[model samples]
Target: MAIEHADVLRAAHLARLGIDDADATRYVGDLSRILEMVDALQGVDTEGVAPLAHPLDATQPLRADEAIEPDRREAFQACAPSVSQGYYLVPRVVE
Candidate 1:
């Protein structure tokens, strides 16, 4: 999986990126190394290995679901220009 200079230039053009010749040369080597690393990773054996959500065995503590504040819906709705059936009314913008 070797990345060429022409490939880098084409990718840059497609992405609308402004890259010089020196930067393109550097990217060709960097991209080639990244692909080589990916190729190496693909060669690993993991036939019966199970996937894990997290590396460490830990559980997050959660608080009990309970309301701690008093309801003030009527008080807040009093400040609105229009409200109907426990909902704020808004001017229609579309037909």
Candidate 2:
């Protein structure tokens, strides 16, 4: 899990990051320590631990789905920069 300068440089190239020689050495050591910590965590027993999506047990009430008539279209269209036939007109992109 000890990351070398070569490994750091290779990782930088893969991630499209431009890392200089001085920073490469420092970054390699940091990355090595992180990898070591992860490797150490492999020794821990996490059996019988239930995976949770949310930290707290909470649920939102589902509302009934039904289509309903909305307010005035003319009023809504009035806010648009440009509107025609209840639709906003956007600038043309392709010729």
Candidate 3:
């Protein structure tokens, strides 16, 4: 799980990062420690632990999917500059 200088450079290149020699060396050490921590965590025993969708178990409230307003397409279209058969007309832009 040791991160090398080449690994750091490759990762930086893949991520589109512009890192100098000093920063790349620092990243190598940082990334190696992170991998070591992950490898250590993989050794933990959790056979009896149950997976949870959320930390808290509570139902989320939801509103009814019904409309609360009347349609006003005619009233709105009456104010438009140009409308025909309930459709707005715009000038042709493409040749």
Candidate 4:
């Protein structure tokens, strides 16, 4: 799966990249190597291997979902400039 010069140019064009002659050659070599590696991987035998959600088999420690602060909505809303029907009112700025 060797990437050619035309393929590199086309990829660059599709990606909206401004690659010059030297960069295009470098990209072609790098992309070709990457494709070769992927091709090699496709030939590998992974029949018995189980899929893993995470690389490490460890459970994450989490804190209990309990309320740590008391409800103080009324105390906080008392400092607002205007509030009615448990809702804050603001001046109408737009139609």
| Worst 10-residue lDDT window, candidate 2 | 63-72
Which candidate leads in lDDT? Answer: 1
Model 2 TM-score on a 0 to 1 scale:
0.46
**lDDT, candidate 1, 40-70, per-residue tens:** 9678787898877888898778989988879
lDDT of 2 at 25: 86
Per-residue alpha-carbon lDDT of candidate 2 for residues 1-95, written as tens digits (9 for 90 to 100): 67888999999999999989999989988998899989997797879977777887997779789768687889888898999877789998697
TM of each candidate vs. truth: 0.44, 0.46, 0.46, 0.45
Model 3 residue 85 CA deviation (Å) reads: 31
Estimate the overall C-alpha local distance difference test score of candidate 3.
0.90
Q: Candidate 4, which ten residues in sequence have the lowest lDDT sum?
A: 50-59
Q: Judging by TM-score, tell me the better candidate of 1 and 2.
A: 2
Clashing pairs in 4: none
Q: Which 10 residues in a row give candidate 1 its minimum summed lDDT?
A: 41-50
The lDDT ranking, best first, is: 1, 4, 3, 2
Q: What lDDT does each candidate get?
A: 0.93, 0.87, 0.90, 0.90
Q: Please give the distance, in angstroms, between residue 73's alpha carbon in candidate 3 and its true position after superposition.
A: 24
Runs off by more than 4 Å, candidate 3 = 45-95
Give per-residue CA lDDT, model 4, range 12-82, as digits (tens).
99999999989998988899999998898778788998877798889899999989989887999999999
Question: RMSDs, each prediction?
Answer: 10.5, 8.3, 10.6, 11.4
Clashing pairs in 3: none
Please give, for residues 1-95, the per-residue lDDT of candidate 3 as tens digits.
Answer: 88899999998999999999999999999999989989997787879988767887887799999899898999899889999888899997798
